[model samples]
Target: MDEWVERALARFPNVPALFGWLGLDRRGHWLIQGERISHARIVETIARNYGVDDHGRWFFQNGPQRGYIALEYTPLIASVQADDTLMAHTGRAIESVSALYLDEDSTAVLDTPDGAALVQGADLAWVLDRLRADDSDKEIDDQALSNALAVPSGTQTDLTLVVGNDRLPVYRCDRADIPATLGFVQAPEPRDGENSN
Candidate 1:
């Protein structure tokens, strides 16, 4: 195992670990030791067990869910799916070194390099503190950082003030749900005789 993976594993022994290169398919899904798991499963498990806020950040089972959500933080937009080809292409263009997956409550933290940890709640400050303390030379664009921090706090929507970076938009939701809300057309419905529709 690589040094980072080794360290991450030591940090988060319970959570699964995966590794991947910047753009290449040389990436592995979350796994317990050597057992591989699908990305869909990971997402589903996190969503079902951990509830994600509008900001796309996973949190612990505080409101509705009962467990923790697994977040995937990487420099590269590897798995981010979008309808616009240009956006997808752009995401693939920017390569990232490491990513982080943790619950909002900060109880379980997992990374590609195998450095994992458990904290109390969704302590963004603490996570940022640890990231800064680490020696990794990863570089994340300002916009990405802003998006990450844009997660809603309690019932306030004006939490944009928390983000110190002006480069990132104050309110941004890039997932598929955003497109749907923006009036993106769905696929055409088939005729009654067409394929039993």
Candidate 2:
């Protein structure tokens, strides 16, 4: 959260929190009443003020009002930069990465510094470039990736990726458990709070 936004909240301590009116789509675009939010400044403000509550619900603390955001896929999106680096859609530079998983739907999820965010498919090549055979640093192909997932034994070989100045290993996780593993609620319900303004 931005310090100014925090100050605004402190200034107007009785503003109401809005819900069901704001949303965050799969591509990281902000939406209002089912329409796309094209205003760059508003989007930037929302992004800058975005945060989560103690209940693990994501929201944009807009100046004095808290607008709970309903996410389409994930609360955040990790985009590939022109320099092959990764950044959150909210404009946060990815300093450290914990895990990465490619689902059957070709959706790549990343546990980055911001949070667990979905990586745009078009930018998956950066992740693929780092995946190598378990025993070697040689690159892996589609079939090889499948084989890594289809081991007959209990243990399976995972992949690896390098982020910033660290070499991190990627793990394969069922997409069904993403919310649990990442500790984020995809479909956050309404909360009970004082209706003030």
Candidate 3:
């Protein structure tokens, strides 16, 4: 959150929070009422102000009002940078990745510094290239990949992803279990007794 936004919140402490007006798409695009936000400055500002609440709901603190974002997928979309580094859709650089998983949808979900992030669909190829046999530099074959995906969700597989100088074990995760496991709400709504208007 920005310093000015904090001051605004202090000045108008009773400003009502807004919901259902903001959303984040699978590709990391910001949406408003189902429409994409095209303005670069506005998008950047929202990204800068975005944060998660205690209830695991992600929101953008817009000056004095907090607007909860409806996420289409994971909270952040991870993109492979030219230098092979990872960056979140919110423009935050992923300094480190602690965990890795291949979801039922074949998308890579990573536990990054920002939070749990789904690798951008466009970067799946890059991820595939980095996948290796468990604890080995050998690239995994298609049959081995299939075998890994056959395991039940939440089970650690015999696969690993080569990230920079680290090799992180890969787990098989179901898409449905991602939210609870990652602790993020895909569709954020007001909690009991909270104002919906």
Predicted structure with the largest lDDT when compared to the true one: 3
The C-alpha RMSD of each candidate to the native structure, in angstroms, is: 18.3, 3.0, 1.2
Model 1 scores a C-alpha lDDT of 0.28
The regions of model 2 sitting more than 4 angstroms off are 2-4, 148-157, 192-197
Q: Model 2: which ten-residue window has the lowest total lDDT?
A: 148-157
lDDT of 3 by residue, 1-197 (tens): 89999999999988778998999999999999999999999999999999999988999999999999999888899898999888899888989887888888787899876778988888888888889886777788999899989999999898888878888888999998888888899999889887666
Number of the top TM-score candidate: 3
Backbone Cα, N, C clashes tallied per candidate: 15, 0, 0
**How well does candidate 3 score on lDDT at residue 125?**
86
Q: What does the lDDT read for residue 163 in candidate 2?
A: 64
Superior by lDDT: candidate 2 or candidate 3: 3
User: What lDDT does each candidate get?
Assistant: 0.28, 0.76, 0.89
Model 1: residues with Cα > 4 Å off, grouped in runs: 1-35, 39-43, 52-82, 85-197
For candidate 1, the 10 contiguous residues with the lowest summed lDDT are 17-26
TM agreement with the true structure for every prediction = 0.19, 0.86, 0.95
